[model samples]
Target chain A: MSTHFAADTTVLLGRSMRHVTRSLDTIITTAVMPIAFLLLFVYVFGGAISAGPGRYVDYLLPGILLITVATGVSYTAFRLFLDLQSGIFERFQSMPIARSSVLWAHVLTSVLANAISLVLVLLAALLMGFRSGAGVLAWLAVGGILLVFTLALTWMAVVPGLTAKSVDGASAFSYPLVFLPFVSSAFVPTASMLGPVRAFAEHQPVTSIVDTIRRLFAEQPVGGDIWVALAWCVGALVVAYLLAMATYRRKAA
Target chain B: MTTKPPPAAIHVEGLQKSFQALHVLRGVDLDVPPGSIVALLGSNGAGKTTVIRILSTLLAADGGTATVAGYDVATQPADVRRSISLTGQFAAVDEVLTGRENLVLVARLRHVGSPGTVADDLLRRFSLTEAGGRRVSTWSGGMRRRLDLAMSLIGDPPVVFLDEPTTGLDPQARVEVWAAVQQLASAGTTVLLTTQHLEEAEHLADRIAILHEGRILVDGTLAELKALLPPAQVEYVEKQPTLEDVFLALTQEHA
Candidate 1:
């Protein structure tokens, strides 16, 4: 059964990867907004805001990557919604192969496609003079965290993809996810704020995640921030996966 | 000496399903013998899709039992799925993939050893070989529907369920699908097709089952069904040309 699952998922992944490769615009469009944010933050706001030393682009790259993922996951919802609308979902469910492979395929595709978008955003940051002195291991660690973060958020995207009544509704869940970075340490340090907003910002998942990634890039000791970051990603992944699967069972039933 | 009867290719007895308060299938019983076609005729909201969904293992019935190829759908869904292919109400082909790729995708999923060859053969048989390389998004409605049917034929499952296969198609396209279905009959595939079109049932099914208000009101061959109604009146009257006839004549003249 496990072997059948791997084969089914590989085949379905190839199918959606063809979709991803053909529709180059979904990736480009996803990358564009975060790239614009990177530019606006680095050039326009970098002069006024003091980010405590190095290039603002360097300080800002981690947050922009999060925004990139938040934006890219909407395409996952959009693609899944199209599958439901086309009746292909039912066709697949009625087939003899592993049924769970259908959703697993989409989740895997979201991770891969969002990884490409992250790379594009990273390239844009490099063009803006962002640099990292972190070692190869640190870079791999960054990749690992981002991969889990993407997986966690992709499952969240699946819920709306299954339940939303309209295309706009399906993709609408990402707006808040994209906005989450601004309130966190992504743009301005949470230490600067002094109120309920600061309290909320400091405690949120995005803050710890961004802090951990930023610290890694700066070659600073990650301390306990890395653990908190992994906890957030894994926690969100568990809850979202359960919610999405339950919803899928009802919808398929 | 006593002999056991052969199991049906598809069977359902007292199958019941509901969505909260809306009762869909209420004790619907049906059977399709091996190598025959059964047309499930019903009006809108008559639960035709519900029956097909249950039989194809896409949905669990609320009560009773269904079996496809001697495997119970509710108890042994995997076996039932292996024995049946479903062509849904819409064209389920992936719009981004080429027609041949769509066929190959299903063939591979069904574990066919040489998916490429299977796709190519089906493409030829459906007369889609010329356009098989182009993405399905660019294909006409008829072409897409034909490809949809062709995809369902892969792995050659014993039973096939088609739900409103020609619902939105033009007359020519409908005829094209009918021909494909006729080919399935000649190849001895057991088919249970649903449609609101009585003409379609008259043309394709050996047995027609009329479903109304969540139950089968009548089930029999065309002649038996016709007998249930009053005998046809024999009369002679002057013929009048239909608008279809006029349109065809004018178009032919212009050609």
Candidate 2:
């Protein structure tokens, strides 16, 4: 990439970061539902759900973090949709800046903002007596996994941002994503689920990611789940990036 | 003895665009001389904005070619973009940002030096200095339009396209924007602006092109275009005061 690409992306990313700072409520709102779910499931639904040996909060933190990322990325779609509606995209396109930098700026902003939300959620998890005995490398691995997961979901958000006709439609795409964790081993092991539902829960991407993170957090020997989780995250990110770029080109053209 | 003027800063021939069955521009041709102002006059849905979009490299033409500052828009879009700035029908400023912040953002993106200084200078130029530090959401329509225009000028591009730049502004604000465009032209920038108000075109454009039915019906100096229409017969009547005169007089007095 040329130096201009990096410079232009930084400038545009500054614009998006300014928007995030000005509207603190978006970050707070994104974290609120996931934190509430964390609290509710750990407190109200904890005793009833069979989570084997570990505390339910420990078992559930990985899924709640994933949910936090899922909820946070919808704002990326909403912001992109607003920029499209306001005609700013046209303005930016006409400039001499790198074309791909426009999308990159938003993607980076999503990463930064979601990273903060994840940190906030992690702090709350710790307050609820959730503890991880994993070494430094394991913690780093968990962070890496979360970053990949967020990148995949954020790119997925860009599709509706470019194509949705209305604000509600842009953000509503995240609803199913937030729900996907429930059917997985997030709340309870897939073994306890009925045959058909269990099959789906085991096969979906979320289960692999949650299972991988759960094992790492518990300092267990993470086997093939790590590879499977990486594959899902990387696969989703590549596909979503390509699809989002196609939508952007069609719209901007 | 005067040397021939430089090649046209903007040249287009046989430009065509359509959305499915709705043909917007059909074989439209235009030329804007360097350092001159050309006004595009057309009714709603007359393809004026489409022409601007194509020239600015924001949209591709289905047929024909357009060049801005000697760069073909189809093949050399980056070079074309390097020479042009565009302000759309709506004030495209970011509402969440302060006016100064918006200008700085554009200046920085354009790779200008000392973006803060550029923003400050533009704020003063557009009489937005007082509101420079306030969020654009609190700005009036006129203020937002001025800020939008200011942002477009950050790069000091040689060619500028204003698509109905003063569409929603009040009369006073409209005059202010017109003055800014006039200044831009005087400073050797090629300007192509679209407008619905004949008076606006008359007041600012060195030449006017009337777009109708997906093509330019007539294009020339105001006097030249007037010569094309059938002359009105002479009439003798008592002199009467016009409403425009009365309104201007009243508004001027109030001011």
Candidate 3:
């Protein structure tokens, strides 16, 4: 039974991947918004901002990566919502294939599609003089952080995807998510903000995550932000996973 | 790995399903012996799809015991799922994928070793070989429906649940789908289907169940059902009128 489920999931995962691949626009769109944001900030606003001496682009890449993740996960919710609306889920429920495999296929496709978008953003950043002394180990650590963050957010998207009544509802949740980076230490130091904004920025989850990724890319000692970011990611992942699974169970019921 | 034949294709007794305060299926008891086709006929919202969903392990029944291919649906849902396939009322093929790709996708999901071969076999079986390369979005309604059924058969499951499998097809397409269903039954597949078309039920169903208001109004062979109806035997001679004509004439004359 376990083997049967695993195989079925692999196959369905391939199906979702093919969909993602055919629609090159999904990857392009996900990468473009974040890259455009990165360019607008680093080229247009970089000279104005006092981001210390080391390249401002380098300092901003971490937050840009986070934005890239945020943009990409919206597609996950959109695709899942479409599947729900399409009655494909109803058809799958009748088949002999593993039930959970259907959900996993979509989740895995989200991860893969987002990973591609992340890589594209990184390449564009590199072209824009975003240099990092980070070695293989540092790159691996950065990849790990982004992956966990994406997984957490993607699963969170799953809940809204399954429950949202409209297509606008499915994709609308990401607006706040994309706007999250601006309020954090992504573009500027949170300390520069007014007292209230600074307090909110420092306490929120994205600030710690952005700070952690920034330090990792800078080859600086990633002190507690890594652990803090991990804690937040893992916590969000656990909560979202539980909620998504519960929603799936209810829908299936 | 080796394959073995399954036993007692589908079994159910006293199955019930409810949505909050409303009940959809009430004490529905049925047993489909191996290698037989059972047709469930009902009006919209009469719980025909609900019954198929429950048997396929898609929905949980609030009460009763059921099994598909010898595995209990509630206790051993995964096992039951492994032995069954469901084709919903609508053609559930992915619009983006071509017909062949859709079949191949189902083959891969079923873990069939030779996915291409399995897909080809089904394409030929359903006479979809000509349309195999076309994307489902471009296919006619009947063509897409055929692909949906073909996709369900890729795994060669012992039991198949087809929920209104022939709803929107033209007469020719309907005939083509009927041939496919007949082929599956001839190959010893147990099929449980729900349809509003009485002629379809008469043509394909070995046993027919008429469901009304979330409950089975009656279940028997077609002959048995006709026997239970009001009798006004008018033995047809060469000059006799049709049954409908007779009823209309009698009722109008009385009026």
Candidate 4:
């Protein structure tokens, strides 16, 4: 790609970022739900739910963070739907900028906004006696994993954003993503579950991701789970990015 | 130091498009001379916007070829896009941003020198100086349309396509937009506008092309088009003012 593509994406990213900053309530709103879940689970059910050997807050924080990313990506889809409906996409498409830059701007903005929400959730967890023994390298690895995961889901959000017939349909895809954590080892141990349920929880991407992150935070030896998490993230990112671009090209054409 | 002038600003031959069973444009032909305004007159669903979208490189034609500012639109979209700007039917400005911010964003994307200054200059030119700092959500429909046109002109492209620009504006706002368009044409920018208003075509277009059933029924000057129609039947009656005349007179008086 040419330098103009970068310049154009930066300019458009600035536009989307402004939308986020202008409505600070959107970021707060995304963080609020995950923080509430953190509070509800830790204070209400923390004593009852025995997740592994460590504190439940530490174990639950990874899942909450993932939910935060999921919730944050929904707004990306909603905003993209609004842009498509507003005819601004057509205006941008007719310009000389790189076509893919438009989608990239939305995806990058989603990453930035989700990262901020994740940090906010982390700070809240710390206030609630959630301690992490992980070092800077481990923290960086966790951040890398979350970033990749957020990128994958944000691209998945792009599909509904481009093709949804209504405003609600654009955002409805996130409901399943947010609920996926509940069925995994997010709030409870998969080993405690029944046969088929445990099998499904162990096989899904979120369980692997949450397990890897929980291990990273507890300073445990993260064996093949890290590889599985990385593979899931990278695989999802590749597939979602390809599908999103194909959908984008079809819509733009 | 003399060079031959460039060819037509826009040229098309047998341009066609279809959406499955629906054929939108069927072997359309057009030629827009440099620095001239050609109004594509058509009713709703007459494929006027489709033709404009294709010429602006926003959509690909299923068949035939089109060129804008001497570059083939199909093979050289970047060149075509670089030379042309479009203001879509809906005033497609970022409603979350202030007028100045919106203009600056487009100017920066177009790589115009000193984007802030260009934005300020455009705001002044478009009579949006007072509203420059206000978000577009608060602006009147007319103000938004002006800002949309200002954004399109940020690149200083030689060719411009305005797809039913005044579609949803009030009469007063429509006149204001027409004045701005006339100013652009006077400054030597080629403009191809699609409009359903016959008077708008008569007032702004150097040539009017009547689009019917996805094809041009007639393309020529207003007088030439008038010649194509059967002569008006003469009637001996007292002269009477038209309702349009009364409306214009009343609005002018109020102004």
TM-score of chain B of each: 0.93, 0.94, 0.87, 0.93
Q: lDDT per prediction?
A: 0.93, 0.93, 0.86, 0.93
User: For candidate 3, what is the TM-score?
Assistant: 0.90
lDDT tens readout by residue for model 2, A71-106: 999999999999988988889999988988989999
Just chain B of model 2: what TM-score?
A: 0.94
lDDT of 3 by residue, A97-174 (tens): 678888888889999999999989999998999888888998898889888999999998998899999999998898
In model 3, how large is the Cα lDDT of residue A159? 88
**Which scores greater on DockQ, model 2 or model 3?**
2
> Each model's DockQ?
0.90, 0.84, 0.53, 0.81
- lDDT, candidate 2, residue B223? 93
- What TM-score quantifies how close candidate 1 is to the native fold? 0.97
CA deviation > 4 Å runs, candidate 2: B1-5, B236-248
Q: What is the DockQ ranking, best to worst? A: 1, 2, 4, 3
Q: Which is the leading candidate under DockQ?
A: 1
- CAPRI-style grade of the A/B interface in model 1: high
Q: Which sections of candidate 4 miss by over 4 Å?
A: B1-6, B233-255
Give the TM-score comparing model 4 with the true structure, all chains together. Answer: 0.96
DockQ of 1: 0.90
Per-prediction TM-score, please? 0.97, 0.97, 0.90, 0.96
Give per-residue CA lDDT, model 4, range A166-199, as digits (tens). 9999999999999999999999999999999999
